[model samples]
Target: MLRVLSLLLVVQLCVAQQLEWPKQYTAKGQIILPYGDIVEPFTAYVDMSGKGRSRIDYYGGSAIVLNLGDEGQYGAMFKIVYETTQDFANVMTCFAVPGASGAPVTPQGVLPDISMYKYAADYMYNDVMSEIYISNNAEEEKNNNYTLLVRKDNKNPILFRFVGLDRLFGSHYDEYVIEYSDFETTVDATVFDYAKKFTCKGFPGPGLTLAMTENPMFEFVGAGEYEEKHRSYKVDSDFEEFKGHHSRQYDDEGEEAKRKTHFRHNHRYIHSMNRRDLPYKLRVNHLTDLADGEISRMRGYRHTPDSPRDTLYKPSISDVPEYYNWRLRGAVTPVKDQGICGSCWSFGTVGTLEGSQFIKNGMKNLKAFSEQSLMDCSWGYGNNGCDGGESERAYSWIMENGCIPTEESYGGGRYLMQDGFCNVNKSECGAKISMYMNTLPGNVTSLVMAIAERGPISVAIDASHKSFSFYSHGVYYEPACGNGADDLDHQVLAVGYGTLTPGDPDSEYWYIKNSWSTHWGNDGYVLMSRKNNNCGVATDASFAILN
Candidate 1:
């Protein structure tokens, strides 16, 4: 009886030792398959910030990064097979597929749960001995067990290895390993920062759907709750004062001020992520307005001398189906992120080319053309490089140059995010645009028909409102945003259109493809108010011709 009691006491002590584990550390190792192949070598950097917030990144694209917060939890996985380099972060900066689809097989259970194991060990590595443990089912998979090693002193797992038959494949035994090293009690705060670089098309999780403030304007209800919730976020002492200032200005100036107002201009009840930390001037609108001189320079149509103009031939199309998405048609291209560069012109230009080529040549031959070529080379023909640019100028450059290189070939498959000397090698060109047609300014019918017939149409819109910066979803319609041709500042692609209600014409909205990455909106697209040229979306619609 005494011997049995001693064993129980020892087991209790073992579990107690693992109660407080090292939350911030990095583990590096490789996976050895049954065939003795060492594959998917990786280094996982982890940050568990004690508030149920944790981020894990594996060196290779095999691991998916998890970003969780109170606002909206997002998680996605992608394997960047093409980019194999030392910089894992850059590889993660690319878009990831859904976790279910991504690899290294997202197990139902993760490593570090070592309670199921019964044995322990003191393994020697780098001339130092560390105590560890073992488990037959580290991930609770049938025919799977792991050798778990714990820190010599802390009792936290320092090395973990699962050796068992592959339950999922049922073909061979598998070996997974993780060796924790270079332990640190605390990590840099930036380690937990949600990177806008990596993204998924739609919201990984769900909450409130985005909507514009129209007749049924959303009323701010949780004022006290809003103020209390934001107190935790780092802000200046005068944040309350700033809120007060906007509140007074909004209430005092009557309806005119309300019409021309922004997010904080009327309501302070907003997601903390939506708040901008910029100075008042920069925050007034979400974007910088174009100079009058720049507008004048870009307004004129610059067509290729020998190219034929596109004649508008509309089919007497009836509103057939309740809803339509261009992605279903398979012509839409993979959304490209422009990074920090304001070269929306390049993205818009590239999107036009991708869609046109896919529509003309079919899906198998689709290619992602080079935006860098236009960014670096089109400066002489009126593009501003990283500063900003116009789509018309990009089209004109395409017409003159015959074509640009594929993104894979250009710059050796990387976006510089800065201007570089243009590579004018004709052999690198992957696709060519014969001509481009600009639709009548403020013509919704023409833009709709054009998109239905062709594919995505390059457009310029007024994305100056602060709400636009953090727009998630909805038919964004802000009448105060103005409806002038000159209001267009940001260039994007109109991939398709849809209706919220099946047969309601008033429910129509355009599906806008943005360059700000898939995490920004409904998987990198937005539904803007349709039929009225809301936000001046139809002000300048154009598409490429890949003949």
Candidate 2:
């Protein structure tokens, strides 16, 4: 079946060529596809000197000359292909370049290197689309027969097809893909003017893919290869209590009638969080405790203040046994404190919707959903104050009964009972969305990998450190005391992941993008320790797959 399809495709190519550019000829070096607009075209030039021989220059680069022979003996032929209207236009402008003396040269400064002697005849032949072929068949090479096979409708048209005399009798021709995009354009009548802006686009032609040959042009001793050596150790310690020893303090003093002032303070005990909170479960058991005299071997050991957590800790779609297909990824947006008003249910639901919508649309530009709608309409599902509620249940409610617009929505410390219709406009809210789920245990590496492979993930972590702020490339772990563990309760999104070391066994890191505003961490992002799988909060330990 595949072979039959391939043959039919080749036949179709021949028919398309007859429909687009029917006239064909041989040329030296390169060929240009002519478009009516001098602004765009598939163009190439040939360099026939030095050891580089037949180096064709098209777009911004050049391709090597595989076979160049005397004029008559059967010069080598190159095939060009076009697939779209854009592709047709690109080739047309290339053939329009006039003589050296012609004012307002063809393509009017669109192509940089417009040569007069090398560019043969400029005509339009119909095969598949309008195309132009240039060739150098001097009388000296009259016997030299070159066949330039041009195709109009093909999947990969940005390649050059080459057929040599050696394989002309029976051997099959090999295809070469060309990767050149920028060619020089000109305003004044000049052949080699390199000052003008050149509008460049890649050529989608047949056989352009196989023309690339690996070239090793430079050589240097001592600049080659080297082996790196390091030692390892194993340290036995409580991974949960492991914290770096460093501390600084600040003082706030003021009085209504007196001047207020802040003071600088210092301390030795640096409050550190348990490494286990990081995305990758750092195998501390195999690491040497620098704090202690334990000489434990370590593997990967790269560290960043803010990086994505590991994928191993992320929950897969399979994690949710019931909703095996409900896997999702997204971002988290902030919601104002409802004060005494119960609105978190709305925020949570909207947040989840935002993420799901983003995934559905396959776009990074996420739109906020109406939370006010949920607060006013989600009866029996949400509370009425700063109190919390189940986000999943809210989602279920909204999915069943639909939601309204934020413009018609109202809620805060107070609630106004009002009924509004569901407005399809998804831009009336302020909360962002992100994927939510739990990750597998001890799979910190896999979790980081997953997040990187997928988008971001939503997680619930022990943010006991209310004032979680990271600056520069350092994670200043400081706990905030507000609603305590309750206020300590908050949700955020994890955007990306990175590794501390290129090869450290424990070097895996998570590049987490957060929504606590740009003020928190690295512009609202945090690089939690991935080694101990700390980033994957307990709640996100599992996931659901939604195909």
Candidate 3:
């Protein structure tokens, strides 16, 4: 009997050492994956009140904001998950029943209880170590070696570090850690309020749709308490705002209704995206109303295989700048619109040639090189003109012809939508390149070197997603971006690189100039997530070697 009593007492004492956290608190740190890889750093906001609410912004990566419903609400819950990078955020709001799919998208959207409360549950208090006094400074984490933590009140833990398995590691037996900080007691009520009350009007009700995102309009969605009253107010007000912003007028009432449906979709998506408070914003721009096929046709890039010599240049960059922009040096030309043409390759090709010429002449504007020259004349070299083409073929055509002509020298252009007869004078010469160099697949270091030390590099990226089309500002990044030749469908120039936050490697970005006009992006440029080549910025990138 005495032995049993002693064991019970010891267990109770062990449990007593647990750290009691506030109902609402926030933490920021890195997510070291179980496979010994560190993902983009993240800022997590967790609230365990009435219904648990949490928000996580993973640097320039994806973000998650969800609300766990209470019993009184009949287990109603809502979640919005975005597959994003620093450049752009692509969202999927499918709420299939929990066990329907094993993928991240299939996770139970509605749960019986607030799972966030489990962070401080009974089982998490084991081996809390001794109580120690420490100030809220950098020295504390190093002095204690992340063994234990005690906050200002000396009651609960301020520097709480949870080292656990990503299980995710499976047989490898690896572990990941979340060192939590910035503890608080009160959660901002306004955080998830808008989403919790969202009606998702003009769209289907939130349900388990057994597929990837079926529509782009539902990008920023969080299923709220199903209500009918919100329909009239939310949809009507948003429609008016959309009309005023874009100054739109319909031919008839039916057409207005149809446009309203698209407006509602984009309005809801834009609202949800802004609510995330991520660096980037999605605007109801010109591409917003365009059909999906139209948007796809706009991204014209025909993939060409890199020759053996292209693979020879391995990245050997030792030191790179924290920030660099070719635009600041006047190496970049003013943004031009591609219109409805699939001439992105020609634009990127011309951009690099123009930059090389500027650099070779010591920042002297020789002449504006003609993309139409490449579009019309490079057809025999396997370029499809405005229909679609590869930068490699265009470069080859330039090399074969020995030089490229200025826009005026080539008799201007035959508009962006079509190609004209090859009018190369054969003797025409403006911008010239001795040869071009290529960067290895996904080798971002070489990309930086080529851009900083040489000139702008023509790069291909997977920008087919609607999120990229509607991007207004902020670093564009999405995890779904692939680096394969087939995956890359849009051509752009990597003109510079920079960091949004110092000391954070994930905050780095690549400044890419696009040919989508000054009205698109931040005056026709996008800051792509750097370091990781998030959108295949380095894959098949070519630099003009001007003599």
The model with the greatest lDDT is 3
Q: Which portions of model 3 miss their true places by more than 4 Å?
A: 1-263, 277-279, 305-311, 314-318, 426-428
lDDT of 1 at 222: 12
Task: Give the RMSD in angstroms, all C-alphas superposed, for model 1.
Answer: 24.4
Query: Where in model 1 is the C-alpha error above 4 Å?
Result: 1-269, 272-323
For model 3, state the Cα shift of residue 166 in Å: 48
lDDT of 2 by residue, 407-509 (tens): 3333432323223333334423433323234455445545554454444444444443312321323322222223211232444444445444456545444
Question: What TM-score would candidate 2 get against the native?
Answer: 0.32
Q: Residue-wise lDDT of candidate 3 within 312-419, one digit each (tens)?
A: 454556676767888898988888888788999998988888888888888877457888888888887888877888788887888788888877667553444578
- Residue 256, candidate 1: Cα error in Å is 37
The TM-score ranking, best first, is 3, 1, 2
* Best TM-score among the predictions, by candidate number: 3
* Tens-place lDDT digits, model 1, residues 1-547: 0001011113321442343445565545543322211233444445544322334443343333443322233333322212223332123233333322111112111245444555543566445555555554333333755555555665545555545554544533333344555455554556445444445344323212111110001111111222224322222222344445444333453332223222232222122212212111112222112222322332222223342335343435644343456666776677766756677878887887788888777655767788888888887677777777777788778778888688888777677777887876733777877777877768887777777776788888887654566466545776567657667778888888877666766658888888776645667778888757878888778887675
lDDT of each: 0.53, 0.29, 0.59
The candidate 2 region of ten consecutive residues with least summed lDDT is: 260-269
